[model samples]
Target: MITAKTMATGLAFAVLTGGTYAGASTPKVKPNIVFILVDDLGHGDVGFNGSTYYETPHIDQLANDGLVIKNAYMYPTCSPSRTALATGKQSFRTGVYTVPVLEKGNDQVSIFSRWTVGEEHIMYSQPLADAGYKSIHLGKWHLVGPYPKKEMEASWPLKKKLGQPKPSDFSWVPYHKEHCKAYYPEGRGYLKNIGGTYRGDPALEVGGYKSKTGGYFAPFSNPFMDQKNPKDKWLTDHLTTEAINFMDEHKEGPFFINLHYYTVHRPVVARSEELTEKYMNKLGDPKTGQGMETGKKKLTTAQYATMIESLDDNVGRIAEFLDQKGLRENTLIIFTSDNGQNIGSNLQLRGKKGYIYEAGIRVPAFVNWPGKVDARRTETPVMVTDYFPTFMELAGIDYRGQLDGQSFAPLFKGEDKALQARPIFWHLASEYRNGTCSIIRKNDMKLIQFLATGELELYDLKKDPKEENNLALKNPETAQLLLKELTGWRKANNVPLPPNSSLPY
Candidate 1:
């Protein structure tokens, strides 16, 4: 295992060598990629990341047999993180700073800059499809703008018009199908799309977003997904079945499966009575809050655990199916979550889903390829934007695009110094559950600048992983350096600020 001291030395060497780590070349044969993105899963929610309450044997096995990325991060929320993953660009570049609408009212304080990522940006799937890969996108694809007119009008009605009072106004255009259809998974580049739509949650077709089950238990409301099969009870299981069937049909050669599961996100619906009962027995009682607390109203810890277990079970099913089809050897499976845990516990990490802290941005991540990626844990910080270039490198695609991330493909070949000298960034210009802020991390030191208040917070993550102590005042030079870099990055990327922000610095 590579220690921190060795990694620091590697960082020094990388800095001197112009940020390049010497490692083995890319694989000759393009491996089949199975990128599994879990919605709202926290860093410590999995067994591999030290979660004792949630049993994730399949996920744990993958981490044990593969490489676990200790410092992988995403955006504070789902939309921006998914945007970075899909487009290989920062939120500033894509103009998707937060969710579709500012959750916390869009007044003069906060403004929703862009409803959805523009269709002009090229999705990662396009390059993969061009490289002779049969790609299929299953489950949630929230990159598309807002829901259709009916759902938007009913659920999220625009009380006061901000722009012109016409139907063609830019502010009122996101609710239409014509605006969103071009950004769906199929239009972006995936050969097939199942259940990939604008809806962020699994709202049922009958009662809309407030449906009892949230469309988790059959009769899914997703118009993009085919619901002809009566045996499809759980949404997770249904998506997994579709993934397996797709792989089975295209088992001849290289294929890409973007299996983004909507499990453990919202509504907190249990997969089955048996699993719920099992968790209830283990968690004591939900009435008195005796077990794990989800921090969400009407969401019990047992129900949350059941959702996680269901996800793990389906992960195991996918692995088993791959093994059965003799595709496990050459298939590269990347498992990770979009953001932090919203309902369940994030272990000892600070903050929740919408905060710019460890719990909100840091997520559980791992890369498993039987004989390719060796089993090891590395503290090389990787962002969601890095996946696209990594996939391109692995597939030998010479992409010449404006990407805000560097490929960490060398790390898969046991190059621990691949990303030690790199600095990852996050820009949240809109306020939701947390304030608008921009964060930068270089090595073990991280600096967060609150845009609204211009509060500078610096923490040495190696010493204080939970960000309990602020080192900005103590380490003035380091804080200033990081702040300067952060400001330069924002200016270079043309990052917009909240209307109520006061950057005193």
Candidate 2:
């Protein structure tokens, strides 16, 4: 059977020689791309997304200034979602079903030992490099798998089996010696990767160096970050400072900067005591809103609210910088989150970060390009994988590779009807709240199948956005049709089918 990667590659090649895929009117020059991927932000976290609690003035303004994709979706967790963004392929193609957590054995690892973006697969930066665009990565970089300790170098398969690519491959700079020679970002696709180490910060040990300090704060347990930062310095402010500095240096023409912030994830560190108190007063004593699966009324709401406000403040800072540099009109700003909210967020949407439900997969996304992308709300279903092709298309480069995602570049120019019926797929072999499951969404109808018990659920998202109704048994014909498509896609992608242990045949 032909793999999904091969099929996507063939399709990509077929469109390479084809005319401008962005439709009749393509921009004369490529716009600077600044992608801001927030960590663990939920669909209803921002003000524009109907969050009655958190304050996000800048994010709301950004939505007012550009186009908001109502049906944007990402992987339930971090690694696979980011991998999809980087490679434009699904987990089945890149072998990163989730964060690379291997259950080691004495002799052999699981047949599914494959993780991390495969060395051969084209990264998002690689295509942009040929287009004369300098790429920079800042903040969280969970794509490179777990950081290999110096002692584990000998056994690190990421170093031997799948070594890192060259610097020209993407310009990932700040490649250090402690980071296994082949595992550095400079050798990949980023030109400068400040604080862009494997996994999110506060991970205790980074690049073989252990940080004994607190996480997220100035005294962070991250080696990539400076220990000299003022004790009061916040990670969000520090990263925004680095971003502004980068923009100051590279605001001339075209550049791609991936500003992946590690805010609102864990530890829920607030930027300032004043802000925390401010939110506390505003939210009252109880600080009640929507909480995670752990239960409602999580006291962490004030801290989470303050954290989101800080993120918004930084967004304002960037927007102001662009205006000051006169680059606002020509720049393309894509903002969204990596996955769902943490264990204690997501208002109306069901489930939290670790499930394949609408709340887990659906995220808030917007694109701002001044005169290019008009300000409006579009219900077009966009996936994390679509950004790769969209960016390449914007750069006037034809991407002929295996991509599970297609370009929605036309949507930027107010083309709302494009990609109307595209099917977005998600698979998580790793365990989560809903257990091992796979999902496929075509139009408003969604089908989720559990791998452990072969249980299936069908929901018409249009009628029931909350996903309270399971139409599987009630609508047998529609369920079977979607089931057939889902199973066929699994087969085509060579996905492993779950065993029916309960069968009494």
Model 1: which residue pairs collide?
Answer: none
How would you encode candidate 1's per-residue C-alpha lDDT over 1-505 as one tens digit per residue? 1234433553464454343322234457778999999999989888888877779999999998999999999998998999999878788766677775545655445655454566556677876777788889998887755433333333222332212122112343334435555667777668788887666777644454356777787766565666755477889999999999999999986999999998888878877778877877674333223255534432477778889998999999999999999999989999999998887665478887888889889999999999889899988999999998888887877665556788887788676564788788998766788778889999999999989888999999999988999999999999999999999878765577766888733
TM-score, predicted candidate 1 vs. hidden true structure: 0.86
Shift of residue 153 alpha carbon in model 2, Å:
11
Model 2 superposed RMSD (Cα): 6.6
Task: Please name the candidate that would achieve the greatest TM-score relative to the true structure.
Answer: 1
Q: Using lDDT, give the best candidate's number.
A: 1
What does candidate 2's lDDT look like per residue over 1-505, in tens digits? Answer: 1235643654564465231223223358778988999999998888788876678989999988899999899987787888888878777666666554422221121213244454556677876776678777788876664434432334532322323332122223234444443444555556777676664434443322122222566655455666455444778888888888888898886888889988877756667678766766663322224432122244467767788999999999999999999999888899999888874555466777867887788898999889889898888899998988888778887656667778887787665454887677887654545556678898899998877577889999989887999999999998888878887778766764323222121
- Over 4 Å off, model 2: 1-27, 102-114, 147-182, 203-213, 230-232, 284-288, 291-298, 415-418, 498-505
Worst 10 residues of 1 by lDDT: 160-169
The segments of candidate 1 whose C-alpha lies over 4 angstroms from its true place after superposition are 1-27, 105-107, 147-180, 206-210, 283-290, 293-299, 416-418
> In angstroms, how far off is 460's CA in candidate 1?
1.5
